[model samples]
Target: MTTNDNPATRSDRNVERAGKLDTATLSDALDKLGINGQCYKVKARSTDFRLAGRAWTIKYGPAANPPGTVGDYIDDVPEGAVIVLDNGGREDATVWGDILTEIAHRRGIAGTVINGICRDVALCLKLGYPIFSRDHWMRTGKDRVQVEATNIPVNIGEARVQPGDILRGDADGVIVIPHEHEDAVLEAAETIHHAEEAIREACRGGMRLDEARKQFKYHQLQTRGK
Candidate 1:
């Protein structure tokens, strides 16, 4: 229940808690905590896509002299972990494709968030595999890029993502909640969600919008505290 709880004990619970929250609410919580987690310009492949899980971070860079494999790390990713691929925001080549999507989906992997582009959009859509990325392109990254590292800290949408951090994505976008702050962020998000629901209920009961907002201290919900 506290932020300082052991991560091993809280990881599953935190991921479940994150699943019940939308990115907007989590983003608001991050704002209140003065954390930058909103993944700018990285959007879901389809508005229907949604996922929540611990991050399995990967960083990609230009291929070496021999040009290593583009995606040999997929097999090592654990189930229910969201693969966070940092490709330096490149759009010229894709680091993910249909094969990876099929394998990930079959393996029960939560989803994928790419700081670059992905290919084979149709397969992902068909499999109901969630993919949040800068864009989709057919161009392959085979000879252009290689996996520099795995399970390491990486940047996604200018937001630093560490291995085991919580990643929640919805129609709007993705938000990364640092593992250390998951408890606080989830608690704040729940508070915000409840407050907003209360406002909506009050409106339905004939209370003025302004009155409802004031009653819930809605305007200050996301304000950073001293």
Candidate 2:
């Protein structure tokens, strides 16, 4: 079968499974699995938005030798991939703005995550497009910072995101699930989610909170190994 028709070749299954989960649960799963995928200091523009998809990584660095462009890579991004930008965590300059937002929105791109900052906050909020970043500012990155690489592994907050890796983000935060360990991570996250639900139900059924937690092994839920 063709690659497009082959479910095994696509990240649809993993993305679908992770789509149901939040960053919190996914973080816990990553922790349990001894994987460092939780991003730090990254907050969503709107807590109402959540995104899960393969990563399209972009790395940025200080401009040099006449400088490079801030954007221009959005056009090459595939549908359903999160635009992961590594701006070296510089909040002083913005790497994304209104024009890119409009284009990404129209193209059906999943979302954008930046280690630095983004401008045009109003447009992103109004369009309901998900943007997770250190902060938003008015200063532009043009001539200040430029694209150093595309589709390469980049650091987002403290998380190392590689191209094609699964990225799931929400109001809580963002987490990276390495492509090779997706199945294990998804299984662990789902297990943790169910266990938490069971504990909640048990408590509502008149069981003491402590007893319910103990019954469901809440402490061990996020603990590494069984």
Candidate 3:
């Protein structure tokens, strides 16, 4: 429900907007917060492409190399959006690459996270694209798989990502944070991150962990500590 209707009218994004998150920030945000309501723990890549977006998922599998490469589904991608591609755990076929990244980046797309393989690693990196895939492969999709639908429910491992759900990704992997919990998760995450930052700085300043915890109440809930 937090999905904005017009890009120009978007407000309340103080840090970085969801649609413009980079790999580091996306990862940090996920590490900072968690959706208390719902999300999925889907399959993903290690170094292929790292991405985050408002989840628009698709579930499909019937062949080794699935079709419906994400580029073909661009019409559905909103400006300043990230695309979460679910390939039903197929890891051998690659559906994303240089051309796709270029198109997406130019379209104001935030990034992409795939449940399968992605190609054009060097190209995407050069483009400063944030993409995450299960693996990289030279294989191409021949349209064997059909999108059949978009913005539909799709599962990633144990998580189900629906349209409007948040996708966060980084070197640690990707996580889908539900839209309903955005405010709570973001607020909690920000508090947790700030506390951790302070602790880290204190530790670097030669304070012992126990001493820092005693001074900052690190173990207690942030709200209570304040």
Candidate 4:
């Protein structure tokens, strides 16, 4: 059967591709393609963490009269999907914490990213469950925010993320790959990765840095196409 016929195979391939790329190289590719996929301000709770997977987006809004749950959606997230939480950049409350982290880790979910804040940092770090967000706080989002929707378009650190979009994060930060541009972005990222590697090798082999960079057209790698 063709790869497209197997969802597992496709997901594996996407994760593998994303695993090989860092946010820096991916950011350059996005720049060249004129796509604003770089998530600003959002950072990993620990530099030791890394994440790569398709997005399972969740958007949050103010809770209703009686308030609502903050993280009942964990059980429904498919394995290998990055849980992208858009809490409207709220810093006062957190949409994630120890319970969610524990469950997500046990379920083999790729990771979690939030535009707002998250609590329970110690648990995530201990479990090596990657968590990226604006920052970590002890406040709970219980009665303050509620899940507005799931598997829907959401914004994280100003970057628009839609369900199934590829997200890759590292010590640098996270970048979203729109599903429609996945192929192009991956291709560009691979090309840039190889070129940069070649430049590095040439420099190590005694070639001048300037000459190597120029030979690889380094300065133009991230330039917007005409």
Error of 4 at 92 (Å): 0.5
Looking at candidate 2, what is the lDDT of residue 24? 92
Range of the 10 consecutive residues with the lowest summed lDDT in candidate 2: 1-10
Clashing pairs for predicted structure model 1, backbone only: none
TM-score of 3: 0.72
State each model's CA lDDT, in order: 0.90, 0.88, 0.59, 0.88
Residues 1-226, candidate 3: write the lDDT tens digits.
Answer: 1232422212236224443444333344544453322223333343545554566555555444544433476655766566767777676666677777788888877777666777877767777777766667877654644454556666664466777676666555666666666665566555555666788899999999889877766666333224
- Per-residue lDDT tens digits for candidate 1, residues 81-178, read 89999999999999999999999999999999999999999999999999999999999999999988877788999899988899999999999999
lDDT (tens digit, per residue) of candidate 4 on 64-166: 8898777787777788889899999999999999999999999999999999999989999999999999998998898899887777778998899988888
The clash tally of candidate 2 reads 0
What are the RMSD figures for all models against the true structure? 4.3, 3.8, 5.5, 4.2
lDDT for 77 (candidate 1): 77
lDDT by residue for model 2 (1-226), tens:
0022211114478899999998899999999999999999998999987888888888889998799888887777878889999999998999999999999999888899999999999998999999999999999999999888787778998989888899889999889899999999999999999999998888888999999888888999888887
Against the true structure, candidate 2 reaches a TM-score of 0.94
